[model samples]
Target chain A: MTELEFDYLRAYLKQRSGLALTPEKRYLVESRLTPVCRRFGLATLRDLVGTLKVARDSAIEKAVVEAMTTNETFFFRDRTPFDLFRDVLLPQAMARRAGQRRLRIWCAAASTGQEPYSLAILLQEAGVKLAGWQVEIVATDLSTEVIEKGKLGLYSHFEVQRGLPVQWLLKYFTQIGEQWQIAPSLRSMVDYRPLNLLNGFEALGTFDVIYCRNVLIYFDTPTKADILGRLADRLGPEGALLLGAAETVIGLTDRLSPNPQHRGLYGVAAPVVRAASPVAPPVSQLRVAAR
Target chain B: MTNDPAETRTCLVVDDSAVIRKVARRIIETLGFAVTEAEDGSDALLRCAEAMPDVILLDWNMPNVDGYAFLQALRQRPGGTGPKILFCTTENDVGAIARALRAGADEYIMKPFDRDILTAKLEQVGVVQADAA
Candidate 1:
């Protein structure tokens, strides 16, 4: 692939998805897109880029974007986040939303559904606390292929073995030939949708908890700030956001702040000026802001 | 399991395959454990009788007292229940996994595992810290 073709593909991917590919990642684009070129019967990366420039084939464009997006995820990946959800998030959500008896979680960039399905298993385990509660897990990813796979809830032996606890595997999955299929109940618990983080999410409604882990590290600084601000808008008043262990909001955006009690947990940041003020706001102003 | 002044944890890797034992040993040792290798379940049992390990990575199918039989016997021995047993096998059947769990295996590991899978399994069973992995 020439420099021009690489640049076009990089910009195309950035616009379609929020993947900010660095110059060093040129090889990654070439390697990942070579198979895509072959799959589409194109001769080389140059030919693929030429076709994408015309924008004639939506299928090829979709394939190129999907090829560039990383879908690395596992059941209960980075166990601490899941532990925090069960031990901290659930109890807090229960106490704050007892009147509503409803909890909605959004797993943004939910590659192959492992993250959301893991949460479903936890919710199942919390049967007593969540009794009679209306629970919903909205799982979305940039790749439609992964979303479809997630909807099927089928995983290979190797896939199931990664980070999934043995008891949960035996309890929640049925072995068919060599692959394991997650229980239908758990599969149904998550509503999988193909979504690009660059696009709007107001249609999905607000969420009590949003898991946008690992996906933010791929975006540029401005994109990270934009996404973080939008994510804060989607969060309910008492909602919490969990990012990947390696990610942080310190340099990204002021819309969300880290939960002091927990390291990886984040929530919407209060307005800096108002929060710092010594005097209390009037009840009328507070009620108006609530609306 | 006995610890030296350094307090390194002990792990017993039991497998008929020398390659797997070596790989597991290399991975476990990085997690601050002194790893010992045995060819099969009978040899593993002898190792346990001499001095118990903190964790055992037991192969399911082996000659002369298979993993299941050895696990049953181990649980019955004095201070046998002290070690965390992780049943490692190619068997992906739920019934087989449930059987192993019932036989007192603390966790399960599928065959052809890499360092990450081994580390994750060890962390799940509390044999290794998450940060250490």
Candidate 2:
């Protein structure tokens, strides 16, 4: 690809999905989009771009975005975030929502459903502890194909082998053909939807817990800040936002700050009123890490 | 399978190689399981007879009774249904994995796995940390 072509492609990706690709990532673009070009029966990279440019094609655009997005994920990935979820987050959220007895969780960019399903299993295990509490999980991803897969809840042996322990499998999955299908009860807990981070999130409503991990790294700094700002707007006063360990809110946005007691966990900017959520460590006692 | 919470679950590691046993022992111990070593199938059967293990990491190829034969014999013993058997070997073929599963193995792991893979396998077969839930 020529410099002008590369620039066009980079600008196109940024405009379409808020993905930031530099000149150095030209090789990555070529590798990821080559198969898309072939699949669409286009002769070359420039031909694909020309085809995209001539008309407003939603189908081709969807295919292109899906091809570019990294859908790599697994159940209970990285472990610590889950540890915090089970131990700290859930209990705190439970306390805050105790009177109302209603709690909602959103797993944004929930690739292929593993992260959300993992949360369902954890919540299910604590069924006795959470009795009479209205609980719901909303899992969303940018790719429609992945959303369909997430809805199916079917996993290969290799997928099951990744992070899922046998106890949960035996309790929750029944072997159908070669794959293990997640139990119907667990599947019913989540509502999977196709979501684009660049679009409006008005329908998502407020969430008590939002997992926007790992996805922010793909966007440019401004987009990241914008997304974080919108996410903060959607958080309930006592709600918690969990980010990828590699991600932080320091320079990106002033709307969020890390929770002192919890690492890689954030709270909405402004003075947190310690009126409802018992799980939140007192705001006055928050130990802010120096940027 | 032991319902007693106080009982530390035991894991019998059966392999001919010392290095493999040491590696398996360290990983199993990290999961809070009591580790027992047996050089081969015969020794493993003997150790299992004295006190049943909750989980077994059996090698496919070993002297003094191969894995399949020992598994067949062990399944006939009382309380044999309790322990979850995992065949850990260099067998990467589907036929070997199917064979092990048919011979009463609960899980199968190919050689050259890491700590995460080992833990996940153990967890998949229900060797979960009590507090992790």
- In order, the TM-score of chain B in each prediction is 0.94, 0.92
lDDT (10s digit) by residue, model 1, range A1-291: 888888887898888897899999988998899999999899988889888887688898889888888899998998989999999898999888899999999999999989999999999999888889999999999999999999999999888988999989988998899899999989989999988889999999999999999999999899999999999999998899999888889988888999888878999888777555567789999999999
Off by over 4 Å in 1: A274-291, B1-5
**Cα TM-score per model:** 0.94, 0.74
The 10 consecutive residues of candidate 1 chain A with the worst lDDT sum are: A271-280
Error of 1 at A155 (Å): 0.7
| Predicted structure with the largest TM-score when compared to the true one | 1
lDDT of 2 by residue, A52-166 (tens): 8897888877887788888988788867688799998999999888899988999998989999999999999989988897889999989989999999999876676678755
Model 1 lDDT per residue over B1-133, tens place: 2224277889999999999999999998887898898998889999999989999999999999899999999999999999999999988788889999999999999898999899899888887777676
Query: What is the lDDT of every predicted structure here?
Result: 0.90, 0.85
- Give candidate 1's chain B TM-score: 0.94
